[model samples]
Structure formats: structure tokens, C-alpha cells
Target: MNNKQQIEKMTDMMSKFIALVSYKLPDDVENKLKELSDEETNPLAKTIYNTMEENQNLAQELKRPSCQDTGVLQFFIKCGQNFPLIGQLEKILRDSVYQSTLDTPLRHNSVETFDEYNTGKNIGKGTPSIFWEIEEESDKVEIYTYMAGGGCSLPGAATVLMPGEGYETVVKFVLDRMTSYGINACPPLLVGVGVGTSVETAALNSKLALMRSVESKSENENAAKMEKLLEDGINAIGLGPQGLKGAKSVMGVNVVNTARHPSTIGVAVNTGCWSHRRGKITFDSDLNYEINTHKGVKL
Candidate 1:
């Protein structure tokens, strides 16, 4: 296809992809939730799980969004340096989101800051937030799109710890945030923790960590251990689904850590509610696409 034709195709594909993700959970997340439901002994927790399952089913069968808050659009992209559409990728995404708002009737979440008016297009200054990672020696672009609702994004916090506070302090910070705000997020939550040299980097990493599957583990051993410990600690809080009080509180916790300056330890925490509406898509240099978000389905 010519460049213009390719762009149009991509835009159309992304609109459909956004609609699909609004209603469905990723395959891995769906399975994990089912597993957790089977393992839970609390009656209320079990009921919540059953209800969630039914909600998903109704959404799929009836072709409706699972949650009323379809959420603000966010995309994490790993683009190949050699990709033909690299230069236009950002514009393509913004346009796709704008088109999707009309096509899927996605909630109008983006608004101008001082103007205080809905963009209606879901595409405005910094709307449909997109983060990019350029990779060498790759011919395809991989994108993870997420809907970060107000509730789930509430617990997101970032602060720089004094050097003396140490890495353990990071754990404590996350645990504290989870205990205090995890309930509001509709557990079991997927917790994302980022550790770096500065608050901004940590905060960004925390948001990026949300893109990882709940079943995935950190690469560093210490980080991995901390992930397990935090998961245990958060689950013990008994926030349950919709914070009603129950057994486990989080689906899983994934920590992404980077080298830090000697003076400070930066820590940030971001969470995803049980619905966790996110999707993954891969496109070749030619812009041919495959979406791997949901299971047993083709588009």
C-alpha cells in the first residue's frame, strides 16, 4: 500500500482495536483473575469474582464497554528505528484515537487544561498520551494501549527518598500507598512500582510497569524479591474487589528499577484496577498488524 493508504488502514485498525480493548481484558489477565477466584475462600470475594466474570460476558455478548469510565487513552510504544511509518506514527495514533472516539463512542476524557472544555476528538495537546521507546535492530513496532481510569490512577505517587532511606524504603512507600488507596481502585489490583534516581523517571517507570502482564516478573533478583514481598504485603491488606473487604488485595505487583544517583532513591507506584483494560499490538515495517490482546478472536 502507498503511505497514505497505509496510514488510513492503520487508523481504521486502531479504532477497532480501541473498541475491542474497551470491552475485553487481556487473555493472561482474564485467566489470572479466574485462577484467583478459584483460589479465594472468602464468600464476598468469590461473589465479586463471579460478578466480574458475568460483566465481561455481558460486555462481549452485547458489544458494550465493560466499565462506564472507558478512561483516558494511553499508549506505550516500542518502535523499530527502521520502521517505514516511524515519523508519522505519533500523528497516526493521535488521529486514530480521535477517530475512535467517534467510531466507538469512547468517553470524552481529554480536555484542554485552562480552557476547561472537552476536546470531543479525544486528541488535544498531550491527549491520548503516548510514550515511545526506540529499539535498534527491530523491524516491527509493538504497542501497548491502556485505559487509565480516574480511580485506578489515584494511588499514583512519586517521591525521592534520601540516600539513607535505602531501597527498603521504596518497598515501604509502595506498601503504604497500596494499603491506603488500593481499596479505591477496585482490587485485586495490578501494582506497578518504579525505582530510579529522580521522581519523574520513577513515576514514568511506574506507569510503564503497568504495561507488563500481571504474571510477569522483574529482571533483577532483588527487584523480583521485592515484587513478591510487596505482593504479599498488599494482598494481606484485604481490600478485596471494590474494596468491600476480602482475602487477596492485588492481582500482582511488578517492579521496574533502574540505576539511581548516590544522593536519592526515587520511588513511584501506579496501579491498575481489576478490569485493567489494556491491549497489545504489533505491526511490521509495512504496517501489517496483529493484535494479541484478547483470546480466541480474530479481526
Candidate 2:
């Protein structure tokens, strides 16, 4: 195929992939939910988990979205410097979002700010946000597609803390948010915590954390320990399934940290609700593709 045809084909593939992710939970998330359901003792929590499983099955079987709020699409891209389609990547992704809106019939979630008008197509000024990271000496591109649903994204927060406050403050911040507003996002959340020198950087890191597998751990020993501690502390809250109170408040806790300014500690929180619609796909120079987050599925 010529370059034009290649771009069209890739865009179509991505559109289908987006639709696929909207309906199907990633493998890791599905497994985690199953484990939680089996381990849950509360009758209400058990019923809720069972219903969630039913929802997943029906969505797939009927070829429909799992949730009514199809969410705002976000793409986190890691592109290799030598990838053949590097030049066309941005346009391809934008086109894919537009096509997915029509093909998947995604909920009209994007609205024009200040103007107070819905875009209807899920595409508007700066809608369908894309973030990029260029990798060195590689020939493959990895893209993380996430659906940031309204309720879950509402709890996102970031702030700069006094250096003296320390990591303890970070823990307190997350706990406060979870206790106060987490239920609005739905319970058994996968909490992503980001620590950096500034609020924006930390916020981005927190969102990135949500894309990680629920079973994954940070490389840094301290961060890994914090993850475990936070997970334990949150689960102690007993928010359970649908926040009706149960054995666990969260599915997992993930921490992503970076070197911070000596005077400030920036921390942020992002939560992914139980449905957690996200997927990872990679493409080589030849445009050969692999789906890492979902298995036994074709785009």
C-alpha cells in the first residue's frame, strides 16, 4: 500500500481497537476483579461483583459498550525514533478517534468549554488528548489507549506540599481524597499516585500509573513499599464493591515518583473505576501489531 493507504488502514485498525477496548476489560483487570469477587465475603459486595461480570459478558456478547459513559479518549504514545509511520502518527490517531466515535457510537462526551455546547462527535478543540514520548534506537511504537470516564476522572487532584511534610503527607492526601470522594468514582478503584517536583508532572505520572497492570510493582524499593502500604491502608477503609462497605476499598495502589525540588513535594491522585477500560497496543516498523493488554482478541 502507498503511504496514504497505509495511514487509512492503520487508522481503521486503531478505530476498531478503540471500540474493542470500550467493550472489553483488559485481561489483568478482568482477572483482578474475578479474584476480588471470589474473595469477597459481604453478600452485597458479592452480588455487585457478580453483576459486573454479567455486564462484561453482555457487553461483549452484544457488541456494545460496557458503560453508558464511553468516556473521553486519551492516547499515551511511546514512539520509536526510527518508526516508519512516525510522521503520520498524530493524524492517524486523530482520525481514529473520529472514526471510533461513529463506529463505536461512543457517548458524546466532549463539550466546548465556555460555549457550553456538546461536540456530539467526541472531537472538538483539544478533545481526545494525546501525550507522546519518543524512544531512542527502537523500531516499534507503543500506544496506551484509556477511557477517562466522568465519575472516575472527577476525583483527580494535585498539589505542592511543604518539603517538611514528607511522604507521610502524600499518603494522607490520597487517603483524604479516597475517604471523601472516592465513592463517587465507584469503589474497588485502582488508585494511581504520582510524586514529582510540580503538580502537572505529578498529575501526568499518576494517570500513567493507572495504565499499569494491577499486579505490577515499582522498581524503586521505597515506592514498592509505599504501594503495599497504601493498598493495605485503603483496603482497610472497607469501601468494598460499589462503596457499600466490604473487605477492600481498592483493587490496587500504584505509585510513580520522580526527583522533586528540594523545597516542594508534588503529589497527585487518579482513580480508575472497576470497569477500567484501557488497552496497550504496539506496532513494529512493518506495521505488524500486537495487543498486550487484551488477549485472544483481534482488531
Candidate 2 C-alpha RMSD relative to the actual structure: 0.8
lDDT of 1 by residue, 1-299 (tens): 89999889888888888888988899878998999899888898899999999999998887678898888999999998988888988988988888878877788888899999987788879888989999998889999999989899999999999999887888889988987888888888999999999999999899888888899999899899999999988888888888887878888999987898989999999999999999999999777778877766664
The segments of candidate 2 whose C-alpha lies over 4 angstroms from its true place after superposition are none
TM-scores for candidates 1 onward, in order: 0.97, 0.98
Best candidate, lDDT: 2
Off by over 4 Å in 1: none
How many clashes (backbone atoms < 3 Å, residues ≥3 apart in a chain or on different chains) does model 2 have? 0
Error of 1 at 263 (Å): 1.2
Q: Each candidate: how many clashes?
A: 0, 0
Worst-scoring 10-residue span by lDDT in model 2: 119-128
